[model samples]
Target chain A: MTPVAPLMLLLLRVTSPCDTGTRVVLVPFERLALPSADARELEEATRRAVAAMPDACLESREDTLARLRGSGDALAACGDAECRSAQASALGASKLVRGVALGVGGKRSVALTVTDARGTEARAQFEAPATAPGEADARAKKALEQVWSPRTTARATREPQGSRMLPKVLWGAGGAALLAGVGFGLASRSTESKLSKNGGECATAGESFAACFSSQLRKGRNQARTSNVLLGVGALLGAGGAVSFIWELP
Target chain B: MPLPLRRTLTLGVLLLASSAASAGPAQVHYALIVASNTGTEKSQAPLNYADDDGARYYELFAPRSREVVLLSVLDAETQALHPGLAAKTRPPTRPAMEAALTRLNARMAEDRVKGDVPVLTFVFVGHGKRGAAGEGAVSLLDGPLTRTDLYARVIAPSKASFLQLIVDACDSYFFVHSRGALPVGPAYAEAVKGLLSDRALARYPQVGVVLSTSSERESHEWSAIRSGVFSHLVRSALSGAGDVNGDGKVDYAELRAFVAAASQGIDDVRGQPDVFIQPPAQDRAFALTDLKDVSSLGYLLVPTGLSGRLWVEDARGIRLVELHKERERPLVVSLPVGKGYYLRSRGREATFSITRASEVVEAGGLPWHDVSVASRGAAQDAMRDKLFSVPFGPRFYQGYMASLGIPQPVDEAEADAALVP
Candidate 1:
């Protein structure tokens, strides 16, 4: 064999095992006195829906039953979420799907529950006329799709690039303004210290000392005012940025 | 056994005994809540609801605390409004406060001697200002209680394992930390360094602080709630609504997030109050209130599937807790069990009752009915419509924690494990 052929073969072998997406097992739907055929149809529809998920691989009913039999778990007895989750973990599956199918009045109703290994569950219900098994299948598929839809898609659509970047821009501006305010504040403090060190020498000394002191006082006042203004603006901007950033988070 | 092995076991037992001794006895909470409407200067406008706020705080903490002291001079109007509360209060003067502090210190010392750890909660709700030298002080009936006076009198002589200081006033940030030329947020480490450098509070490593406004802005009182807005929110938070993670404890970070989320929808910039919170440097998880210690309050469960901004109003029209909820995570807010409360949304309200302590009233089970618009003034309506409009849930809490770089107080794995049940 060529060198490239062996490399490609090795790559394929490495990735084939990892390509088996999240393992999902659909347990038989419990029938509340409903016809077994109808219950089987609803279960088949749900299996199709679960298999249709892009990142999910549905375990075959035969394989799931064999695994349960091997584990000494009766297929009809595993009803609650806890039991289903345990069964799914035993079968090396990450997700478990189960439901109850009942005939209410003239309508066939099904309530499905999907439980992951972490025990986070999502539930949905669908109802259709008892005579129309095809309608019931469609409704079950729709309900299963609704229940299995990922929540992250909604969150991803809530934030856009421009809105996400605005907070960062505001934060940058706020930091710059705060730095400038600190500089001015330090200068003002230095001027005040120098004035204090003079110790009223301007009052007893010549006109030069008095003029110098007055100029220093005016400069310090201006610097302090500017610093306060900048600091206030920076604080407002920073707070606005923080609030906006948090508000934009999905 | 050999002699060496026997000595090692004896040493280990002695070490365990000493550690247990250092842990001390069960902590008993003591509260000194002070409120003053009048300021040090005559020109300052008299507030109408400071005394009411103080009374509300006293009612909330008295049932849970070993002892609670209310320092306020209730006028005829306030006394008539809050009947029998005046008897429990003293004048909000310096001498009165000093004498109260002396008595409390003595009682705390006695408790320590009796092998009980004492925790002192100091709450001040009133007017405050910055002096010419940039020192912050809260006004009392006699005069301003300066920062130096507070450190020397309150922090220095306190015989408590932990001291919690809650202040709601103008420019209250400087009351705890000195303002330098460059203004910066008081992170826990920086605040600890400042406290240590001052040497005034050097011995107190278990001091926590919560302030209303971080800057020189004045915190406004809303007539809609008949109390100072910040104080009202703080009261709600401490009453157990601030326990965001359902951990039965309200930490400083949770309190800050609660206040921020509750006030995020205020339309006017001036009406929004900035919250400053710092837990003790030694313990970031230091809870401001433990719900298990409280007996007078019952919890209202806003369970999964009820989503939006909602507020609970008493029969007397006192709006207590306002929160925005998400559909996934559930929340439980503690309210006084004696009164009937209405959970109000924008156009609907559902009445609920908690007839016994620790009763959990499910809001989702209540029947919601349409509510007609009441003809209040424009300002009141504006304030009512704008508050607590933003939803607070896992998303907001995650964003807040990430932005502040605060470590998650609850382990994700543990939370998930707990959720499974």
Candidate 2:
């Protein structure tokens, strides 16, 4: 039987449902003036980015920045300056995210910046289409995906460990023990059959003393019965363990 | 007494009387054009009130029948094409319409000279069918104006000694009541005739009269005859035929004769003009002129005098309170039964009754009688006699509505939102 071990338990924790480790925050467009190749292309890029990070959680909030900036107004008084400051603060979120979308250009531009909020320099940037139609939605999705990778990868890795491993190990050990018990019980039955077949000649020589024979028969039968009981107990224990593990699932 | 002293004393007495009369009661001209029961399927017929010449002439005329403060009542809901009837999206009929009437009325009352006022006219246009067995005569849209409803709502509060009514519609004569027994019919007759009788005429310091397109038993045309009857006659008169003195402009007396001859299915034209007083220079006459032809005095008088008064009435009516003008004196009276209704001497009050028949409660708070313009948008329309201001741009409404989070009908909100921002 496999022994319950701490190393295995630690591995299970890493793969547990509760340990989806990373988080992300999306920042609003800082510069209204930006050049995008085309609105449609920009939008497509944004959609692709978000779609790529299916497991990521994206949160874009105006109020959070409003409160931080000490103004109830959504569009802050300093226009462009306010936008930049708000975007910066949003990117520097507690949750680790890849980057922030920094809007730039007069007509349209997808010079969006995706930087590690933790180790980012001021105004980290990326290049794409400028002034593309339908770019706004696409860009939003793109920005969301770019910032959500850490959390998504962590969640993907954690899924199988919690759902698959523990139940299989318990059932496999119990099944092996039950099989060994059944084989031992069958071997005892075979030995008793051979002795009985030797009969009268075998009884005079030494194989058939009544007391000894009775004791030997009783011992063999008892061993066989014990093996049968062990097999039943192991099977029951395996089933029960499997059920308990399933019930404990997060 | 010597002859010289007696003559001198008589002249002095006459001078004193003239001076005293000048400082007496204040008088103003008021007129109304109530177009209801016109059997056009919609809430109102489109541009039918305007003359064929492009200018809305009927809205400016109709005071010649008898002069006074004019109050025009148009059935906007029934006249305006609703969603199911037409594909066009029209304006909502509510406070905006009532507000226009009150504004006109108040304006007239404020800028009038003090003296004997002329007759007040209420012209109604729409489908008019005779009364049912127990249900009084009704308009095409189910709830028609009753005779009693017209008097208390229009005549009494307007303070004009004369009440002249011209109903332009098929079978408009059905509104006229001569019965001496029924509660509503007799009351309507008495209130209207009271303005004409030597007694009711004497009670007022002015003249009063009520006229109809047809007599009690006749029917008129809905399209040409009733629709353009008022404007056609006025336009002809204004075009110089009624200018008896050949001044290229028709006066009150001349226009009156013109309308008398021009009206189709003519029934009865009644008036109780004052026989005692000599005619004043402007014996309360109104004429229609083109809005754009300023050089020709080209202003079509869209139902005169009720704009300002109507505005006040609208505000008061919505609140279900009597309008009391700070500048005008209250005309209070005691009913034979129960406590009589008192006209508020301040604030604005409308004297129209909104009846929920099933509930058996008649509320005199809304603009029961109003005018609708077919050509002009609601804000600029001068249908019946009510003058409506031009509508502010749609952007203005979009911005206003956005602030309140109410969805606007126009797609211009995107552009309009920029303005508010």
Best by lDDT: 1
Top candidate on TM-score is 1
Per-residue lDDT tens digits of candidate 2, residues A6-78? 2223233332221222223333332211122233344345535543555544333332233223322222211
Model 2: how far is A169 from its true place, Å? 99
What would the TM-scores of all predictions be?
0.58, 0.26
DockQ list for all candidates: 0.01, 0.00
Model 2, position A44, has a per-residue lDDT of 47
Give candidate 2's error at residue A200 in angstroms.
Answer: 99
Give the CAPRI rating of model 1.
incorrect
- Give each model's clash number: 0, 100
Assess candidate 1 and give its TM-score to the true structure: 0.58
How do the residues B33-102 of candidate 2 rate in per-residue lDDT, one tens digit apiece? 4333233334434334321211122223321221212222333432241112212111212232234335
